[model samples]
Target chain A: MLDSKQMITIKGTKDGLTLFIDDHSSFEAILDELSDKLSEYKPKKDEPVVPVTVKLGDRYLNDRQKKQLNELISAKNCFTIHAFDSNVVHRDEALTWKEESEIRVVNRIVRSGQVLEYVGDLLLVGDVNPGGKVITTGNIFIMGNLLGIAHAGVNGDRDAVIAASYMKPNQLRIADYISRAPDYDSEGVYMECGLIDKEQDKIVIDRLQVLSRKRKDISGFERRMLNG
Target chain B: MGEAIVITSGKGGVGKTTTTANIGTALALMEKKVCLIDTDIGLRNLDVIMGLENRIIYDIVDVIEQRCKLKQALIKDKRFDYLSLLPAAQTSDKAAVTKDGMETIVSELKQEYDYIIIDCPAGIEQGFQNAVTGADKAIVITTPEKSSVRDADRIVGLLENESIDPPKLVINRIRNHMMKNGDMLDIDDIIQILSIDLIGIVVDDDEVIKASNNGEPIALQGNSKASIAYRNIARRMLGETVPLQSLEDEKGMFYKVKKFFGMRT
Candidate 1:
């Protein structure tokens, strides 16, 4: 009952092109159409570089679909994937993040005896008191002090990260990795972030600036696209 | 008209009764007519703490039941001129008092007194409900320990839910050396956890214990640091902004001598 154009549509963006895929179609059928469309938009050697936004609406691509997309993108170096976003975030039963994730932001201080549990990521702009708790299915970002317990990626997603202005929390959990309070003083130290490194299989707490390397890598791409 | 206030804490042994007695006496010393009410009916201690035990002939339950006049139940403070106590009945239970009855009694006293301070029992039971029923404001007491702070947080939430103004906190029994050494929580830590305005902070002093044992309020002591804290709290309650006193400069030769013997700092 569906038309070919309706299943997958690509439009020119300000700096690039955006591909809007109808999430109602089967993954296999959509991926098949997406490849054909990408080939059509393939830029010539002398053509300008254009960033590509793949908006899947509420659905995210599965592992096999992602692999196929990667191969197709590698074969053609014309398109740059700017953002890949979906509306739905999935959580596992045992405190871990799966292939899906969402975000919730709270601006008020979490007082003692208060407990906040979100299904995906949580970004807070206030402090968490000693007896307070913030539990999330994905990463946690605390703009203020985090003196209480924080459990991120509760369903087994090892890639979850937690960052805070004051990261001297009573306890921190990322996926199945749990770390108790480390001997860290809060004098002059303003920023801290934590992540569960898969290779080390242990949680790592580092200066928040460590994330700048990753962010700068992406920013460099934008600069290169603008110049080259 | 008088303002009624309740001193409460969710956990036991956090010094609600002592705070009520000291604050009431301190206010009375400042030429304010204060009436101390004990709402912990079956388990009364304000009378004993104030040393007005023998004078309590007609208890709060007696006045509520109309067995005696309200004036007859109020025991005048023996030493403090402008202070009085409405003692609770040892034989009665918290169910004997109703919210409406307490409101009426407080209103009646408001006509003659400048302040009526209620000493609420420890816990969130009927006693706490009865005590806080007539209060226009509340002062929550807590120690620096984890359990006390946790309970105070819960009580503050309940007070907000009941539409009681966000209660000001009083962190009692803070040992400064321990706080500096990271063994105990400091005032800043407590304030962060409770997330409420701080009314006062009393230091851990032996005078507080001695004064309680003698039924004498530490606020009556001229040189005690705890007394200074209580006086500031009373003045602040009267709409005056009093700056918190720092204990560092006061730690002189006496503190060094005490610390030399490895006395519990």
Candidate 2:
């Protein structure tokens, strides 16, 4: 091979110093280069402790290797670790994130005194009868009538929404805000959605069509499909 | 084996005991050997409804606690030779009876009787659980009122989780005038909300309370509308296909004549 390529490159910006480690290099070689580069590096006297961010390009690091890397960086007294940024994640962590973000579908009558709950978004295909409850951490989409209580964003996600085909629910909750149905019977002929109004700091019921504007991220796949 | 049916309403004073007494009596009139168990314990009323409170020497508690044999505690009905009442213990609380205990008692009674009707106590507590534990089928009773229908829905939900067959519904205390005036819930509305099969509907008749006060079930009467409704329910329970009685039957001949002349009653 020609001259050995640099495995570790350091750059400086307004925020702090950034170390970009070459992923194609062997781990031992990268570690040796990082040690050598850090040993020779010097900060200005006026700013002795420079915050450094380490970027591993498309490289996944296990806990032990991450610990070793942190120790090596911390050994340099002139540098402080800001964070370790990585482009790749372990399969298990990726799977958990996928699970938390995916929508869960359920088809059954949620009768009185029964509670249906999920960790992520919920899509219920049946009616939620009075005295029943449906809860989720993300969003709720009821294809049938929702006559009971529905709680979206149980873990405090304020942006979550609850949409129902017939929205005469006993109560609606989003994040920490709760609002009971009005005493008078609402004309439940049209579909409705409940969400948090940040300006008023209360839950508000709106037309279901507002969902497209309120939660634009939920329509990304549909938009892409339409574009194609 | 005889089928054990539990008559329950999640709310109080929805005529569970009355229905139990009437159905048991109607079944006995059909010549089937019937046993009625009062699971209300400290709040025993089935015996009084069946006019056998004075004859309750030994009770369900006595049978469950082994103080008396099952047959010894069963008080024979005064009207029917085959009808019997196992009154609940007036002194003991609901906690005295366990699910397994009720199961054992009901199964033991099932061996001899053609039908065992259990009167479940109100509220979803130990009393309700004990009453429902031994039943093979359930009849959830509700009125046309909102609160009663809500409670009945809860009872139906709880019953669905059990191993027994899906519970049937009986819309009791219906008022024809209130329904006509739109002041009360419609029978179709109640059935749609409860989402269960309607076995029968009993109109709001003063004769029901009068019969209960005299410790005579209305089903014993031959011509009363409430008695006919109870008999129809009993016949339906026996797998007979009896069409639901029309509310028009309660109207007078003059109302019918006015309707024939296109005049609003």
Model 1 stretches with alpha carbons more than 4 Å out: A1-104, A154-158, A175-177, A182-190, A212-228, B61-72, B94-108, B124-126, B144-147, B174-184, B192-195, B246-265
Cα lDDT, all candidates: 0.81, 0.88
Quote model 1's iRMS: 1.9
Lowest lDDT block of 10, candidate 2 chain A: A219-228
Pairs clashing within candidate 2: none
Candidate 2 stretches with Cα past 4 Å from truth are A1-5, A11-19, A22-58, A62-88, A199-201, A219-228, B254-265
The sequence of per-residue lDDT tens digits that candidate 1 reaches over residues B92-117 is: 86688988889899999999999999
lDDT of 2 at A90: 86
Q: Distance from true position, residue A107, model 1, in Å?
A: 3.1
Residue-level error in angstroms, candidate 2, position B265: 10
Task: Compose the digit string of candidate 2's lDDT tens values, residues A41-64.
Answer: 675676667788989999888999
Q: Highest DockQ: which candidate?
A: 2
